[model samples]
Target: GATPSIDRFDPDLTIRGLLEIWRRNASLKD
Candidate 1:
């Protein structure tokens, strides 16, 4: 079986990383 990425074990960090990526994308649309 394949192992999941570390982010799956640390949801807060995953959410934060996602938010950061979303912010960058939002800024790019401006």
Candidate 2:
């Protein structure tokens, strides 16, 4: 077992965060 933190969160959160970042960057390009 391991303690989860920003450096070790569940994969889902990481992917979602990356998606949100990408979306925000795309919006700024318009």
Candidate 3:
């Protein structure tokens, strides 16, 4: 099988990573 994505590793880590992405997205919208 193929390697899993970040969220597949751990829920907590996925949430933190997702928050970072959201912040990046917000900045891009500015």
> Which candidate number would show the highest TM-score if scored against the true structure?
1
Taking the candidates one at a time, how many backbone clashes does each contain? 0, 0, 0
> Higher TM-score: candidate 2 or 3?
2
Q: After superposing candidate 2 on the true structure, give the runs of residues whose Cα lies further than 4 Å from its correct spot.
A: 1-7
Q: Each prediction's TM-score against the native?
A: 0.74, 0.69, 0.63
Off by over 4 Å in 3: 1-8
lDDT of each: 0.80, 0.84, 0.80
Poorly placed runs, candidate 1 (over 4 Å): 1-3, 6-8
lDDT of 3 by residue, 1-30 (tens): 434665367888878878999999999999
Candidate 2 on 1-30: residue-level lDDT in tens? 434465687789888988999999999998
Q: For candidate 3, what is the TM-score?
A: 0.63
Ranking by lDDT: 2, 3, 1
Q: Which candidate comes out best when scored by lDDT? A: 2
- Cα displacement (angstroms), candidate 2, residue 25, comes to 0.2
Q: Please provide, for model 1 over 1-30, each residue's C-alpha lDDT reduced to its tens digit, 9 standing for 90 to 100.
A: 223776356788878878999999999999
